[model samples]
Target chain A: MTTRTVTCEPQNFRRVLSSMCTEPHPLARQAASRFLATNPGDPTTYRTVSKLESEVVERLGEVTGQSDVEGYIASGGTEANIQAVRAARDFHDVNDPNVVVPEHAHFSFHKAADVLDVELRTVPLTERLVADVDAVAAATDRDTVLVAGVAGSTEYGRVDPIPKLADLAAAVDAFTHVDAAWGGFYLPFTEYDWNFADAAVDTLTIDPHKLGQAAVPAGGFLTQSRKIMDTLAVETPYLESTSQATLTGTRSGAGVASAVAVLRELWPDGYREQFETSMSDAEWLADALSNRGFDVVEPTLPLVAASVSERLFERLRKRGWRLSRTANGELRIVCMPHVTRELLESFVETIDELR
Target chain B: MTTRTVTCEPQNFRRVLSSMCTEPHPLARQAASRFLATNPGDPTTYRTVSKLESEVVERLGEVTGQSDVEGYIASGGTEANIQAVRAARDFHDVNDPNVVVPEHAHFSFHKAADVLDVELRTVPLTERLVADVDAVAAATDRDTVLVAGVAGSTEYGRVDPIPKLADLAAAVDAFTHVDAAWGGFYLPFTEYDWNFADAAVDTLTIDPHKLGQAAVPAGGFLTQSRKIMDTLAVETPYLESTSQATLTGTRSGAGVASAVAVLRELWPDGYREQFETSMSDAEWLADALSNRGFDVVEPTLPLVAASVSERLFERLRKRGWRLSRTANGELRIVCMPHVTRELLESFVETIDELR
Candidate 1:
């Protein structure tokens, strides 16, 4: 108590509908605290955390409909996505390698393209905001080494036709990467052909921190085969490990521990309940906005994009509501596990009051 | 009151003489938990933690002998080092960009080179284990984008001739980076010309998680000029922030919060006491090893590398001592903040008994 006060006050989860992350499950928060000082990067020293990371990867594969997969617990989806593109770029040794992705793919792909010196071809989406199959097919050339599909678009949460996208990449002998960061936990209960069992995905990005009820920075990256994962390995000169594949060294074990904690507590069944609740709340909010004469995108996933007036949006923001705007200037509200139906009802009341 | 038990037990700091990181301060551990669920990547939402990150960057600048520097809290030293190299490579705009570094620079430089598609030129070190000024100067050419000098090397705790290294980089019109990941906290108390005030160092990698007693994954990167830091920015499509300069998105505020916690608690006086204790223990270790007829490198910092027999090294491993070997097949003993002199005395007794 005598120590200096932390001026960085944590934001309330109840007020945050903008971010993809939700409040961590109680077990996850406890687990993260216990492993705050461990580093999984040195597997030999932090052997137990390293093993937990292995289990987390296996669980990610199991939920994504693939078993015995190989990967690491990435810092988050961005690092995982970058590694996927990096793996593809290294595997296919083409001059000026190009990567094709849906326009709705996360911005991490752009960071990957710029960092790795690869050409990024962003294909236009269909009317439903899913990846347009024809546009992706037209964009791919012989130099295209990686094709990415978004299972849950950030702005609209549209699930792209990942099966078709994978087939197109197969035609060019390129790697297929699916960015299911926000939808990895939710898509399992839905009948979407977006994961390994439904599509020939080479690599996938799934963040346990986002929708999996884990603490912050718990992202999962998995490969269907070990050979696909080995393309990103850089030989380690130190440590008991022979090679290192992670983007960052001295990686904290908190993410790994917390991810396993939540997965163990609420994998298929618990997540299913959360998904249903989130979807129902999203639908309710969309209907509530539409009834007020605001144009709204269909709630394909638990994310709604509504066309609110700029002044009203500013006023809502001024009301201390944590909100975000989409690329097309629509109000983006992600109904994460914490964004309950009751919370949305009150949010609508506040909007009505301001209007 | 029951849940699935965590299998990953935290490693004891007393036995961990190999890693640069030590136990997190009690205050830092508490602070890390408070901010575990907050995301600093979207600064507008996690305003307080983002503000703490600003304070951390400023504190890092102050400790590194520069005021009003610009940078961010990286995941760890690896990410910070990678970004430093990436910023330089992006800024130079040279075709076939190359990076010049001393032979004993951390393995992160190699990872950065591989990921960023840059040529790595490793110049051999001098007999003293520091970067050979002539060798580094000879390696640098017009195509060299970055020149790196290790302020505290991993193996022998060598402080490279950073001022000379900076001069060589200036001659080649390249950016200079000082890797002070291990030495940053200690060097401030010692007389070393290895920081912003001592040379024309454009970028520096220092970690609060290492010697600063913050939790794991709290590495700091500071740039002498805003221009160098600006080179790494990518435009953000969402959020109130205009651009994202960090390597990873969806960053956790735990590292930022804990870094400030430790920095506030032990900036100069607290760390000065620890540095003295660590150095005394290190010198004690070197003398203890030498007295037992083992060859030892001089402890330039709180790290001692001794050549023990392969059988003894394996025997020590079997006895549950957390140790590491260098590239030269020597036993490395790093006197981190927790590696007390009494612990080293017991280690010596164990070695004598094993013999």
Candidate 2:
């Protein structure tokens, strides 16, 4: 939080593709350490860190194409999504409020629906593994307060037709929410129009920890207007600030500071370079798996979901490769910034030997 | 999370009384850094950090005097409190559910009430600033689903009559929750029985960041039964595990590992000694302020709330004292583990000079 600038050279993560090896940029870690004791929930005391929160929003705005973005650095995408839906539900005129989300939307939506006491209308995806815009439109009515679309889905890395979904939500007077938690950082470099500038999104969920190279728990929640944000505000009687919009209080300043450092260091250029390499790796892995006669999904983004046998998946786990499976039981691999071609080669060689 | 043991010498924070000075033990910080990249939300991938989370629950159960406590390392007290109320509301048979809380319960209860769409009935405290048991008994009805009592309230460090509150809630078939987020670690050293072993508390909110000297966001939420916890579980479809009871989907492993380190290093003896020093500091400050003709609330625990002139409060803020005021405009001071006699002496001297 002091004026002492931390110097951290980026480290090469030449290890396994497990989330554990998804190391942050050194400066981001240093910033987290320096601000370890500060609490951003009470913004008055940690004024500088609080200001850094604004800078984080500013950078996030630049990335998401919202010039006047207003939001906080959240614990992760889950909190961001929860708060977004809470805001939408707070202003609903009907007693039985419902939220319509894509089938591939993050499970955080389900958590939000349960905690907020609202009906969750899950619209199934199309054959392309993206949201069925027509189905989403059909599920909406007067009681629908929110309609959510996924920018980059968890299982298959599929991007929904956000512009069409936004129009459907608008016709029903429902706020549009974009779950770009996994794609917000990478989509900026690519030709994806999933952000605010591309659609009428009222709120967006983006994570700095995903591809922004920040420490964990740096999820960004951006709101289009003050009315949307103030809907979530609660009075704080014991602090200098009268109201707080965040879901949690007394949080570590690690995420806020780390997000600022990562955004400052990697905006546009550094991140663009990383995304290129990661995209190539994902494409390469998809092709390599296809050549080996394995059923693989298209890697539109830097993520691969392939149909691997149960025995082979267990063998990969035994080799210390932490892998995840999709809802349909396909092996899911996210080509994060740390995932390299070298690691994928080793994975392929192991598959051949095991098969 | 690896087998390598970390040794951290406890550092003396003789600098300031601001929350920013509330640093964790050095080893706790080291552990946080080591596990920064891991996500505890997906337990199957980060198996070791997830195991450490169980160990954290074990240590927390010992400290809270509940041999079998079921909970997770929450983002902070805010999440723990919200989840506790959600669990209570989930199983309520009544069409309209209400929660009864003491006057000084943390504002997070209000946040929970707003988010969960439940009625909040706040019972005023007695002249001694503790919960009014009679008023709490009168507040509960057939629609009441939860009764919450505060242990070490925010503005004033006062413990509610948990036994009486629990009894009243049980008579009405409502769950009882204790918000010991600020007092859990210190009350074990004191004579307070605000935990499950002392009362029929269905859920307790405690923070390892507050007195356990862990990293920030290391909040402990303990439940009496697996049935109570299961009420809040939501299906995490994409994760390795099927269901997760936590409110958030992805979280840093920093708080989880740091809590384990702090609990392991200071559980019975180190924290006991620290409590002795902190309690004395609170009492000493109360005496010093009273002798100076300032009206001071009794520092029952290690927190003091005193009446000071508006000009004096502003001057202290100008002097870089990160102070907080109560709802009634009284200055509140929390003698965290970082607060020493010397720092209190400096604060008192500054107050005298400014006056």
The prediction achieving the highest lDDT against the true structure is 1
Model 1 lDDT, residue A104, Cα: 84
- Candidate 1: tens digits of C-alpha lDDT, residues A180-291: 9999999998889999999899999999999998987788888987876677788776576778889999898888899999999898899999999888889989999999
Worst 10 residues of 2 chain A by lDDT: A1-10
Which residue pairs clash in candidate 1?
A: none
True contacts kept of 2: 0.64
**lDDT by residue (tens digit), candidate 2, B80-189:** 99999999999878989999998899999999999999999999999999889999989999999999999988888899889989999999999999999988888998
Which candidate number maximizes DockQ? 1
DockQ of 1: 0.72
| Candidate 2 clash figure, as a count | 0
The CAPRI class of candidate 1 is medium
Q: Which ten residues in a row have the lowest lDDT in candidate 1 chain B?
A: B5-14
Off by over 4 Å in 2: A1-21, B1-21
What are the per-model numbers of colliding residue pairs? 0, 0
* Candidate whose TM-score is highest: 1
